[model samples]
Target: MKIEIWSDVMCPFCYIGKNNFEQALEKLPFKNEVEIEWKSFQLDPTLDASKPQSTIEYFKEKKGFPAEQASQMIAQVAQMGKGAGIDFNFEKALVINTFAAHKLLHLAKKHGKSSEMEEALFKAHFTDGKNVGDVEELISLAEKTGIDNDEARRALTSDEFNYEINQDIQEAKNNGISSVPFFVLNGKYAVSGAQPAEVFADALQQTYKETASPFKDLSQNGGASCDTDGCSI
Candidate 1:
């Protein structure tokens, strides 16, 4: 089965959802038959890449949230991250445009390393506090994911994967997906948000059953058959 995940690198819940979803898959019997495709989504595409800011400051100035409220929200998300085994340091996280990073993700997808690239970007933004919009930083992260440095740099420096990124975004919009961390299981069922592992496991099993092959041959002994030789018993 194929699972397409729509997520943003800077979204805390996306990272948490990824971990939880993987945990769910680990308990499944047909885990090896699963294929994951990471789709691109930007929470704030209008964010200026040149001016990086802390999450608190971004919330305060851009989103019009007061300092106290922003801090509280961050605290809540951090606690949730802890439950998912993610050490989210929002204090150091810089909110920057992830368009370039998304392009790099397309490049990674071409090389079958999209999962690795997505994980790296999430950790860089939520844990390591790196500027994901920066070309050099993106190249470095891609390199760690086994993507060639020059190829990564070319992808970032040029507009090669912009169409793929935009297509993913457009597809999400058409599908009425207004949130990150949305999971499409086998293109049959949808699971939204950072749901529990049990939820994912159940969805997987249910989708598998629904989509599994229906034919089953039951033959205990050989029967009479006719071939080029005319007849057999």
Candidate 2:
């Protein structure tokens, strides 16, 4: 089965969702057979990638929420992350345009290090407070995560693999997805939001069962074809 996830790097819930989904996958009976694909969906694509604003400030300005409210919200998210065995340091978070980050993720996929790169980028932004939007910083982090520095530098500097990033975003929108952490199973079943592990597990199980059987080919049976009437028996 193929599980495609649409997520943004800056989304707090996305990081949590990634952990939650991984936990659920670990418990699945067919976990070994599952293939996961990470897709890009930027929450805010218009923001400048060079600016180094804190996440708190970004939230405050965008949502017009007071500092205390923002802090409380972040604290709640942090608690949730802890439950999933992930650390979230919202205070140290930076507001970044994740376009290049997502592009690099696609590049990492080719080298079989997409997941590692994804987790590293999240940690760099949310935990270590590194500037993920910067090419130099990203290259350094990539090198630390088993990606070759020369390859990383080339990928970052060139526009190669950019179309894949845009294609992911466009595909998500075509599927009526307006949020991050969206999961699509087998190109048929979709579950939105950072749902609990049990919920995801149940859905995956059900979808697997639903498509487990094979049906006879209508063409082999040569059933009556009706195009104009749109009916067959």
Candidate 3:
């Protein structure tokens, strides 16, 4: 089974959703058979990457939220992060354009390290408060995912994988996904938001059941066999 996740690195609930999804998968019998592909979705595609601002400040200024309200909202998200086993430090997080980071994710996908790359990017932005939009920082994160330094640098320096990034964004739009942390299971079932582990597990189970083999043999021991020219009982 294939699971496509549409999320942005800067989205707090995306990280939490990823954690909850993984927790659900860990207890499933067909965990190894599931393939997870992280798709890019930018919450603020026009944000200036060169001038990153504090996440709280961005919420206050851009969203028209008061200082106290912004802090309260962030605190609520941080509490949710804790429930998902994530240490979200929104105070230190910066609101920067993730276009370059998304491009690098496509590059990592080529090396079969997209999942690892996604995790690293989330941690860098939400936990470690690193500048994910920076090429050098992204290269360092890519290196940690087993991507070669030179290859990562080349990919980041050039427009490599930009098309793939745009394609993912367009696909998300085509699917009418207006939110982050959206999950599409087997391209058939859609689960939105950062739901609990039980929700994800139920979705996984239902999708698996629908996609699994339909045959169920009830014959005992050696029963009877029939062929074109011979029959045995």
- Listed per model in order, the count of residue pairs whose N, CA or C atoms clash below 3 Å is 0, 0, 0
- The lDDT per prediction is 0.92, 0.86, 0.91
The estimated TM-scores of all candidates read 0.91, 0.89, 0.91
Model 1 clash pairs? Answer: none
Full candidate order by lDDT, most accurate first? 1, 3, 2
Cα lDDT of model 2 by residue, 1-233, tens digit: 88899988888788888888888988988888788899988999988988878878987988888999988888898999899888888778888888888877987898888888889988988999988889999888878888888988888888898888889988987889998889999898898888889988998887777667535465757776788869787
Pairing residues by index, what is the TM-score of model 1?
0.91
RMSD to native, candidate 2: 5.7
TM-score of 3: 0.91
* lDDT (10s digit) by residue, model 3, range 91-113: 88978999989988899888888
Best by lDDT: 1
Clashing pairs in 3: none
Clash count, predicted structure 2: 0
**Candidate 1 residues 100-172, lDDT tens each?**
9899889999999888888899899999999999999998998888888999899999989988999999999
Question: What lDDT does candidate 2 reach at residue 120?
Answer: 90
